[model samples]
Target chain A: MIWVAAALLFWGMAWALNAWLARSRHSGLRAVRIAVPVIFGLTILVVWELLVRGLNVPLVILPPPTMIAATFGGNLAILWEDFVQTFLKGALSGYLIGCGAAVALAILIDRSPFLQKGLLPVGNFIAALPIIGTAPILVMWFGFDWQSKAAVVVVMVFFPMLVNTVQGLAASSAMQRDLMATYSASYWQTLLKLRLPAAMPFIFNGLKIASTLALIGAIVAEFFGSPVRGMGFRISTSVGQLALDMVWAEITVAALAGTLFYGTVALVERGVTFWHPSQRK
Target chain B: MNRILPILSVVTAIIAFWYAAVVPMNIHGVLDQAERDGVVVVPGTAKARRDFASLGLVMLNPGQAAKSWMQERPRLPAPHQVAIELWQTTVEKKVTSKRSLVFHAWVTLSATLLGFAIGTGLGVLLAVGIVHNKAMDMSVMPWAIASQTIPILAIAPMVIVVLNSIGIQGLVPKAIISAYLSFFPVVVGMVAGLRSPDAMQLDLLKTYHASRAATFWKLRLPASMPYLFTSLKVGIAASLVGAIVGELPTGAVRGLGARLLTGSYYGQTVQIWSALMMAAICAAVLVGLIGLAQRLILQRMGMTGR
Candidate 1:
């Protein structure tokens, strides 16, 4: 009860402080802009900790963030194995294979108007097939290893990459293609020098999208079948065991991995598409 | 019709590819059966025979190649097998039957629509708050963006478990997970939509001495319609995925997710493929409905150019 009171008090104070900060002229300043959300995040964490502890919430229902951190620290080796199994072996390999294949297919389709017209819709249909449905089927096909997980990730990432690359290839205007024609450039040279460069921003958008999708596919695929060492396997088992802290710990790793995966893709995108209008901003 | 000819040809090409793939994918199993039956065309080891990939070798044993397409638990079920299963479950059986695809589809679709409603409502409300209240913009908007970075698959089970413990079960729990997935798109879209009113437009409103409420009703809300519908299409599709994911963790004996799980468990590849087809079709229907509604509403509003 006291904890609840303290939480309410803290929330009220935080609300007042944030409101004041938001209204102030200096709120437009960069530091203040960052500070508001940071402070807001801290306040919520504190409130959650206090309420859960003070209210004596069951550990299974909601493990405190500190408990999650402690579990993460204590189970480094297991976590690391799970991370490698799911992220590095499954997601990364699948992402590379899928994205590579998609880009190749996209380029091939771009060369033929017939292929583009027919294939894009078909791709969209396949993309709409839910990951849950595919994961189980892929697991059955490839066996209960990271191979199956990779297969799921491959399916999940493929269409988006293909669609984006296809769109990106078309980003080069007809006039620009004609310019290359005037220069007597061959198809391959025009593709390499003009089309591919023009396509970078769109391709990177797809990559950024796929990075998170790959992580998700890898993790979710494990819920179907895995060799006792993957994030999804650990998460499901821990939940069944009522080890909420362990589940939270795995979630933290997943969140961090997802953020880092997306960030890396975005960073690479920035480097590659530096001249694109969106990147310039 | 011209547009459809290419699509038909592409689909026909894919079906042909799928049929061809079935032979190679199921060859090992077929050969294992042949070895068990003591049909030794190859005198060497089973490994050598299995590793060998020649269409000519498969063609030599027409019966065995045919058997690959008809395997009870094939690595890849033929399209006809899946189509037949889909027809049987969806049309032949009673909709109330657990074996029926319609029943499982309903279980998923109910959660999806409910969650989409809850998500769209919450998203619009939050977006409105963020746009109007500077404090919410500062505090809630960043958190909303951060929330999406956390993968929904990792969180679905936790949400289900937590909600289960509190005596919130079945449709509501699944709907919450669906809402979690769908809400982000709506929020992002609505925020962009609401703020789309330019400074010049705001000044024009100010010249009329319009109240905040009036400006919102007359301008901002209408401006957000196209964006809202666009996000709703994405959100509805996402919500279906979420409902399926939520079903997976619980191992619920109902829903398309359940059908996939049960099929995989029993090695009923045809059933699994049928469930997948059902899910894809559901998504298409949902998105189509949203698109139809968008057109109707926009036309009614005299925003057909948009």
Candidate 2:
């Protein structure tokens, strides 16, 4: 019961403090606002620890934060292996291939009206195919290796990247194209100079989106069938073993990877799209 | 005029290639025994003898050389064979039959919808909390982004078991796993949406002496509608993924995950393929439905996107 109280109290205080921080006018006050959530998170963790101890909540259901931290510390090796297999071997490889291919295809499709309608629909249809159902089949065909995971990632990231690139390539208005045309700039020169630059923001949007999709695809693909060392395999096996702390640890690793990946993409976007009105702030 | 013919030709060429690939089934001759220089070859010897074409013909015709093709059928079942199997097993049998994939799909669908609702609700509530607080904005935003890096696929089963030990049995735990996987996207999208109103809009509302609540409803809420719907559309797909991931840990007997497992275990490739196709269809329909809803909502609000 006290655990419940702590959770409620912590959440309530966090909520109140966070609201004030959001409304703060001063830039310094804004900085303080950022800590509000962290404090809230810490408070909840403390309450969770206290309440779990006080109320005797089962570790299986809600392991105290400390236990999770300890478990994470203890199982660094397994977590590290899973990270390499899923992130480096599977998601990253697929992200590169899928995004690269999509961009190339987007350029081709842009040059041809025939491809715009015919190819886009096919891309759309394939994109809509759920990875959960396809991963196992792909694993069977590609064998129980990272190749299959890459295939699944390819399938997952393809559409979003394709759609965005196509949109990006189209972003340069007809007026811009006319200007290039009047300059007698060769088609290749114009494309390299104007269209590609104009398309960078849109391309980056697709890349950012693909990062998430690639991560998701790699992890989900592992659920179907993977070598013994991948994150997916450990996650699946640990459940039967009832290793909640280890699972949380792996989760922490994955969460860290996802955040870093997302942050990198955002940072790149800020650099590349600085001229865009959205980035002016 | 220039484009249409090229597209038609491409389609025609693909179909022609498909037919040509299938026609090789007729070239059947068993090399069970072979004689290099007209010497009589024993059945068990390196030399093999058999009417391979007859076997291929029998397999293809299923009557002309049935005996020969029986040995050759595994390479690829004839289209008719698969078609017959599809009809007899999927169409003729009722969904309640033990053979039905629909029954399994229903199990997966149940978990998906259950988890989706829970995740979406939690996400909205969290977004609300994060948006209303400054400290939360700073701490929670980064944490939320970080939360996603940890692959849910790896933790879904663990979530299931952990929840199971806590006396949260059956669907709820699985739903929680799904919700855990899905909630992040919704929260992120909603937070972005909630903060979408420009300072000018806020200032305008202030000029009217509007309270925070009034400003939120009159300006921010309306502005964020499109963003929220887009996120919800994305969330629904994520939820389906969550539900599917939820099944891997428990190996529940009646869901699509179970079907995939059982099919793989038994090498029922056709069954596995069809189930996958069905899941793909289901996802498409779910996403399409949300898109339709988005269109309706936007149109109702007098916001039209070409």
Candidate 3:
């Protein structure tokens, strides 16, 4: 009963605060913009904690944030190993290979009108292949190591990166190409100097998208088969053991890793494509 | 003719590559077996000789060398083997049979459609609330976007178990997972669409003294049609993925996900490939249907440029 009251009061106060912030002239300020969502997130967590404790809900069904945080702290070693296996070994390696191959292939395809017509549909078809279907087969081929997980990531990330790079290669206008021709520039030289520069924004878009996909592919691949380590393996095994706290802990690791990976890619993109109109601000 | 020619050439090239790849990928296992039988052979030497010379140089029985490429449970199934399995399962078997790809596809499709419906409804409602109300716009929108950062694969098992504990089972839980995935795109798209009516349009409605609901239906709703259809395409594909993931943890005995799981368990590479092809086809069909509907709706609304 007390928790119910507290939850209601907190909700009401948060609503009032947000309403006030929304109406205020200062709402557009950077601090206020950040504070609004932060406060809202905190309120929801507090309410969730209160409701779970007050109702005596089973921890397996829903662990409070505190329990999740505690489990995360206590299991740092396990978490780190899982991170190394899934993120560094699986996601990062596959991301590099897949993105590298896609970029190279995209450039090759750009040179040939026949390839552009043929490969784009095939690429799209491959992209739509469900990761669930691919992950298990990959595990079989590559065994229970990080190699299989990386294979799945490569398959998952390849087509999206390919499609994006293909589109990006065409970003430069025909006039720019004609100008390059007038300068008597070689095909390779024109690609390096003019077209590649124009393609950076789209290439980075693909990179950022692939960053998330790589994490997802690596983690999900572990669900099929892994050598007793990795976020996905830990997550699935913990669920079977009914260790929901540990499961949530793995979720926390995966979420943080995903966000950091995406953020890093975006930061790099900004650095590389600063001159683009979209990144100008 | 031009489109078909390029596709055909690409497909032929891929088939050639697959056939060539099977020997290297599958021969390792056969060599390991032969070594166990006390055949004193070096690893790379044998593979290199096989690559350059005829199969006779590598093995007494050349047929065994050929057999490596066509093993029933080869590490990498040849393209034709998978194609044959796909044809047999999809065409020879009755749709109601457990072996039929159509049966598994229908199971997955049912959950996907259910979830897509729920997601589309919830997304539209939330988008409407966020667009109309200040608090929801400020609070809910950020959280909605944040929800996507947490991978669905990680959460799927937890969702299944938690729901199972509460006596909810099977299709409902899977549908919820699908809805969780599909809803976000819809929310983002619908929010953009609902707010698409410019100030001038709002002013015109205000000049007519129209009620908020009337103005919404008359001015805003029509403007959002293109965005809604665009998001629906993305949402439906995502919903299918969600359904497949939902099947992963439970190890259910039906659905395309189950086929993959069973195939992996038994080392049936051809079965896995067949399921993968079926899922891809299902996705293509779903997306095509959505595109067709989008065309009809947009044409009727006379907004075809989108």
Index of the highest-TM-score prediction: 1
Clashes of each: 0, 28, 0
User: Of the candidates numbered 2 and 3, which has the greater TM-score value?
Assistant: 3
Residue range with the least summed lDDT across 10 consecutive positions in model 2 chain A:
A25-34
- Fraction of the real A/B interface contacts present in each candidate? 0.69, 0.58, 0.57
Better of 1 and 2 by DockQ: 1
The CA lDDT of each predicted structure is: 0.88, 0.73, 0.85
Model 2, A29-130: lDDT tens digits are: 655745765776787688778777777876666677899899898888878888999999998998989898888888877888776766655665566566
lDDT of 1 by residue, B1-306 (tens): 867888999999999999998997887777777778877655235677756764655765656787788887788999998898899999999999999999999999999999999999999999999999999899889878766666766888888887887898899999998998899989989999998888999899999999999999998999889999989988998899999989888788999988988888898889899999999999999988888999999999989723
Model 2: per-residue Cα lDDT over B1-306, one tens digit each: 665665665456555564444434322322221133343323323322243443343343433233222323323233344455556656788999877767766777777788888888999888887787555667778778656554555667776777667677767866777677678988988899899998998898899999988987888778877888878777777777777667766767776677777776666665665666567767888888888888998898898832
TM-score of chain B of each: 0.92, 0.75, 0.86
**TM-score per candidate:** 0.96, 0.82, 0.92
Query: Considering lDDT, which of the candidate structures 1 and 3 is the better prediction for this target?
Result: 1
Superposing all C-alpha atoms, what RMSD in Å does each candidate have to the true structure?
Answer: 2.0, 5.8, 3.3
Sort all candidates by lDDT, best to worst. Answer: 1, 3, 2
- Residue A211: error of model 1 in Å? 1.4
